[model samples]
Target chain A: MNPAVWLIGAGPGDPELLTMKAVKALGLADVVLVDDLVDPRILDYCPDARIVRVGKRGGCRSTPQDFIQRLMLRYARQGLRVARLKGGDPCIFGRGGEEAQWLSAHGVACEVVNGITAGLAAATAVGIPLTQRGLATGVTLVTAHTQDGGMPDWSALARGGTTLVVYMGVAKLQDMRGQLLAAGMDAATPVAMIENASLPGQRECASTVAAMADDADAFRLRSPAVLVIGQVAACRMYGAPDAPALAETRLRRSA
Target chain B: MNPAVWLIGAGPGDPELLTMKAVKALGLADVVLVDDLVDPRILDYCPDARIVRVGKRGGCRSTPQDFIQRLMLRYARQGLRVARLKGGDPCIFGRGGEEAQWLSAHGVACEVVNGITAGLAAATAVGIPLTQRGLATGVTLVTAHTQDGGMPDWSALARGGTTLVVYMGVAKLQDMRGQLLAAGMDAATPVAMIENASLPGQRECASTVAAMADDADAFRLRSPAVLVIGQVAACRMYGAPDAPALAETRLRRSA
Candidate 1:
């Protein structure tokens, strides 16, 4: 039997970032349960399918986890092709693993289609390589907010020697900056705050880890933004409309 | 003027994993530069365009970076649309940032399109989430080998609360296992070694941080493989043909 449900990552913000595999899944979908963060434009790929908004955005009143799972199960049980669409890669803090396991336990077949994650897209949109050689050995993608309301191990991350990309960090700039400082991260370490990454309305604020909170406040950074922290964060390969202080930062990009 | 050069990611090994943006770029290309690791089937999108093979696989005598850059520059100088396709995200250890910066310095406009990175695809292919809530707060993507011949800070990574995904690690499983063990990572921490991720030939061998090297040896794991190290690495949401030891490991996948 064919897979009844597909958990697809709609990609960051840009609809074009969606994978061809994801588009194929959407085309076959009888109903699509989309997250709030997914661009509405992506739904155009599956215009004939029914669309359901089951947003679970932080600090917002939204659908409960169990209800969403049951809804997908109910739709799949009826032999309908169901698509659970989430922003960014479905498994990256999107509860895709949980949902997939639940469906599989119920004897339903499901497949996950990966997408361009927000952390990676946020850095790339502004010409910052997430793992730029010599500057960073690798990249770490974490979120400032967790389900338990606690924070990630800032001390370990500060010493990890990889570019740190923090999702959902707009509201915790000050707290994050302070924690990183206490963790002994360099005060002059560069940070790039990118909002609405990969979208036409994308905006980037350049600052140092020590000055990030202040710079973000001045730039009026908002939610749905990612913070890139490392030497590579200072690099901008080419000037883009979203970058306001491109001239100053371009000097930092190394070969 | 349109971008003269487009550095596109072909995703893991799946041709369908190519993004719409990458496909659009391919469609507009006058010449296409392909990498060795990239699936040739992706060239279907740019069938009418001139195709140049510029493979740069590790441990192989492949195209030189400088020569590839100059070739792209020469093509772009002629005002041609050049698509440089690499496996996975261009900016992630693909020298995309370096190439883009070089091209931009020479007055050529280049764009880097994000892709579903191989590390993420490998984990998801076997129903494993790189970042499962409670099990892992986040995920770190790093390469086992480095240009400078130095290793990443394993101690800090071991202490960091995230799932670790290591690319180009097939040959160094023994060394990596020792390093992680030396860095205080739990000996029994689950490990999933995935080969040819997201492709039809995908294969998985499940073991632990301590026994990975031995298990991989027994499984005859080859290059183009990725190693997932963490508690979340044990979780397999749904069984697939790639996972030969699914029965034993399924019991360990925590909800």
Candidate 2:
């Protein structure tokens, strides 16, 4: 609250998902630098704070990272409490580490408040237990889009026996599918493409490792969507017609 | 507010870390079934609700999962709002999926409100970004303890080029170290064992994959601790006297 930068995750889309700590930080904020992906409703908590939208959409002409950092620094130097609101958990591909390190080096104190990450929220919204027993031993969250525009180690991921959740992967379905298949991943492994995760407009398209690209094309999957690639994607616990209970699904699969 | 079961995550032992949705659910609860790992302070929000302590710690005399499910069903059947508070996010190794499925199968409506998982919170508490550019492409959250008492696919996890966050791993440090070593993970890969993540008394012991067991022994790492294993674990952005800025660290590593 004392003229420092608070790097807060606004959680995935839904305002209700915001943590009490994040809300408290927003309340103390004198100037807020928020990302485009963050819900504006969350700003209601910081009604008195000066709001600055630092939109940095992937593949879009948006605010540069350096400029955003300088803005936060300027506000902090002016003895104003600055809140940098990001979508999802700030440390999870949100450039929180970079910003925190930069702020520290520039002599601005920074505190990171964790939020519900998009990948986890998207999976749960669709009733996919990422680390369900008998299906996945663990869950791996990776971004397909990188600064170098390269790909993750698909072969190792395919072999990991963990549910793979890919961020910024909707556009690269074909390439990912090809790589996973080539890495000997089962074609029948389930895949779930979730759009606008945790938002009211959230949509899910279920497919398989072999058919996701085509299924996504048919489903009109968009950017900002998350892809859940694993057997658990087929295990829906929510209201889906004919969708077996997770326990039953695991029992059947194991049997 | 409806007469249904709400599986809420208590968010890594911090009461303030609770989501607004989880808080709302707790407010409307007529009965709250709480886990042992959940901090007692969170019950402050549901002071009016009947609190049922269902301790289910591993290797301890605890409540049975079946009995817990039945308790939730009983409360819901009586037209009472039931809140089942689990530590961390319900779906992330907290059995939220299994519980939701059980409630749904019993014709009881259930909802899951996501909370900040312990692994992510633990990483951030120590300024270890789970996924920093050039250091880790993504992160894997896995539990070393399982219902079947079997091990995860360590060889594949070792091959996967993502940071590894292990829950319930304090007890199996040596076994995991051996498997990861056999699987070809670098012995010097940095490891940070975080205890009581996100809490005021949170403690972190930094060591290498080869030396974690000994370090944890020296640090007396306890149960309910999370282990972060990766190159990024060696990278601290806050308060370390010689910790380099994340950008510089990444540049140096890539160079």
Candidate 3:
């Protein structure tokens, strides 16, 4: 077979969430290029394939995108089946498009296998509905970073009636809170920060947008955390047992 | 095993996109309760299971939510292994919560298996990136339906800078466009609608938010369409040959 590249999404830290297509692609890979956010256990699916870590963590010393693209090109040129494994759905903020473009430009065939995105996984893991009938009608997934590492456009995000899921936003909680509030967002809008979603070590912190900036230290959340803001965040229950309590709390607060 | 109910997302119309956990659940189910949006091909994995069509399509006389909940309860009472299969991720807007709550209250053990949502799959199927370095920092997933089958509040959706994915919104394209424009959304925001995404008979139509309402009629799109609006929608290339042209179109439009 001609050299080819398979861009696969590993889903959000859960190996079982991997699509059959993604798993098959990994099993057939001659070399697997994995990212930092992807669970290491996923490598077990391709026991025979050589694994290489092309770590790309935000705000860390990581492999440059160009270098990673070149590595994929080089490997494919040598008649190797290369798998570029990404966290979450590759097309959703995983930079898979750039990699696919580079591979296609270099005359290498490429196929993209979709995975469950972090926003969806975080919502499920925390029992928060991204959209509900009367509570929230829409969901917005965003990040805190810009090209120059500046804050995102907060004015647009402050719009009410939309659930906002912020990835890599824990550190900027204070700034984000202030910006949203300043842009006419209700100060008491519900906010929940989920740390390490889908993993055993997952932790959740619930608060209001007004309190997030002041109580940011209480969560002790790190990178890879997801921040959900809207009425839906208020509906999150710790487990099946807390469902009623969570709903009642929201009802009381809203009343 | 004790009587139990498993709520599984069947993925967005593609059998291969089902998670391993979902597939396993289907294999073990004694009865499968499915919705209209779920691809019929998924039933192939559960050949021995009794199939129940409890589908609730919009604007159609469908089974009430309470009625559906009662059916799950009845099935579990018979000591059956029931699987409630929904299209896309169950937690997002699938009413999985109500069903799970009903099951728990009735002493039926329930577990949710997440599946790939149409928003993410639609984005990938059409080569659109929900987020990019300088283009979009966020994405929003919403449905077009309200409880009374009217338009959702567009004032909140009109805010700029987030990619918007609308499920089941094709029939209401004209109303959606009017609402967005009235709420001050930019006229040129790119929008792409994919009908039957990830399935054979898939059709994609690209236009602006302002023009989509009128142009969607030209495509004669039907149900199960996923509409994506933002700079990302411009990333889609019908075939691999138009990659550069697509990118150029995005860049030129943004500039």
Candidate 4:
């Protein structure tokens, strides 16, 4: 028999952001595997379910990926409705892909309920538009969770006029800044770091890439902060469109 | 008095994907400016509110950016609870930033509620993970709407080992394919087109970068289809993480 598993995104620490579908899924789940970042309050949505804390925090004592998959498979075989509740969109950084593939291989049907990604939430909380007219043609969501991988080639990323949202890159602002600057990214490019977005203790700091490390350090920004790099970072600072007031503003971007 | 205005993302095309916050916001709205592509059924969440269709379709008769902003400002100044209901995440490519800034400049308070982006929904619909272990480091959400602007620098976009999700690129696949190839991108890069994603009429097609244009034409994929290009597109064909059974399956990413 196919395993009953649903991978649901918990949506960036905000319980209200949970989709009606995610809430319904949680209500129906017989067993839930919660991520470390997922708020414990979310478990209240699935009160009847047996909850397991699978803290997959980066570089921390966490559950092994293989073992987690095994548990899901075993519970699924027993006819329990297994819900893998992850923080943020399950597909985008949550390792939902691997679990889905494993479930599929074992003939378990998996349904993914998309949720608000942290990058989007972070941008919203800080009033930074990830994409705006005449500036960002797109938004690239990348992570500093490279693990064993080398730093990504930032040259192309720097040139595209797209908003670059670096997740988990708080520890290496200098390296990130150096790569973008070396790739001809303007030193004046505005940068904003939003930490603990949407939470009560959310903090925001803004500066140029050249001085981002200092600003981050000065602001005491920590991990889970989204680093926004692009022209859109200064959208609010610049006045109305066609208004020449912000022309002399130092945050002006040069492509 | 700052009119209560909300920027709500309706999610891809599925009404159920709407977040609880967005639903509540919609119900509280006195006037809602709906985008061209937004499903009409979404308005049921706000049956008492007045709905206005603001067409922002690329390369078509759409609403002017300035006019829309002005209307929003006017209604907001009149103290109407205005809700700008956009199809996907308002901040990502929906021009929500510009509108929000315009409203803020005019002293209108705007609250943004993040929603599920189409690219994530599209990938989920087909069982293709946008980011998975050992293959994709990130996902890039871009668009073919370069109206009045020159085509984006494809060279930089082609370098990163990130999944490229092109929104509204169905009509310009040839031009997009050419740029990626000229930028020295791999010829065999996988591509998947998901049209009408999350709707009953959804259709999916898959091919390689070299043959994507032809495949798109042959498949008759239309506008608004999300085109995914990266190695992970071929992930499902490779089967289990440890199993080598699906190694020989060629480009079976389509649903």
Number of the predicted model whose TM-score against the real structure is largest: 1
Give every collision pair in model 1.
Answer: none
**Estimated TM-score per prediction?**
0.94, 0.94, 0.91, 0.90
> Tens-digit lDDT track for model 1 on A137-175?
899999997768899999999998899999988889889
Q: Write the per-residue lDDT of candidate 4 for residues A128-181, one digit (tens) a residue.
A: 778786778788988865646777768878887689999889988989988999
Q: Is candidate 2 or candidate 3 better by TM-score?
A: 2
- lDDT at B101 for candidate 2? 79
State the RMSD for candidate 1.
Answer: 3.4
Per-residue lDDT tens digits for candidate 2, residues A131-230, read 8877888899998866688898999999988999999898899999899999999998888888888877777877888888888887777878999999
Name the 10 consecutive residues with the lowest summed lDDT in model 2 chain B. B246-255
Ranking by TM-score: 1, 2, 3, 4
Instruction: Write candidate 3's Cα lDDT for B105-221 as tens digits.
Output: 677778777898888887777677677666777777888877666666676666757778898888788888888888888889888888777887667777888788767776676
Q: Write the per-residue lDDT of candidate 2 for residues B26-99, one digit (tens) a residue.
A: 99999999999999999999989999999999899999999999999998999899999999999999888888
lDDT of 1 by residue, B42-117 (tens): 9999989999999888778999999999999999989889999999999888889999888888888888888889
Please identify which of the two predictions, 1 or 2, would achieve the higher lDDT against the true structure: 1
lDDT of each: 0.87, 0.86, 0.78, 0.80
Each model's TM-score for chain A is 0.92, 0.93, 0.90, 0.89
Give the DockQ-based CAPRI class for model 2: medium
Supply the TM-score for candidate 4: 0.90
lDDT of 3 at A41: 92
What is each candidate's DockQ, to 2 decimals?
0.72, 0.66, 0.52, 0.55
> Which residue pairs clash in candidate 4?
A156-B156
- Lowest-lDDT window of 10 residues in candidate 1 chain A? A246-255
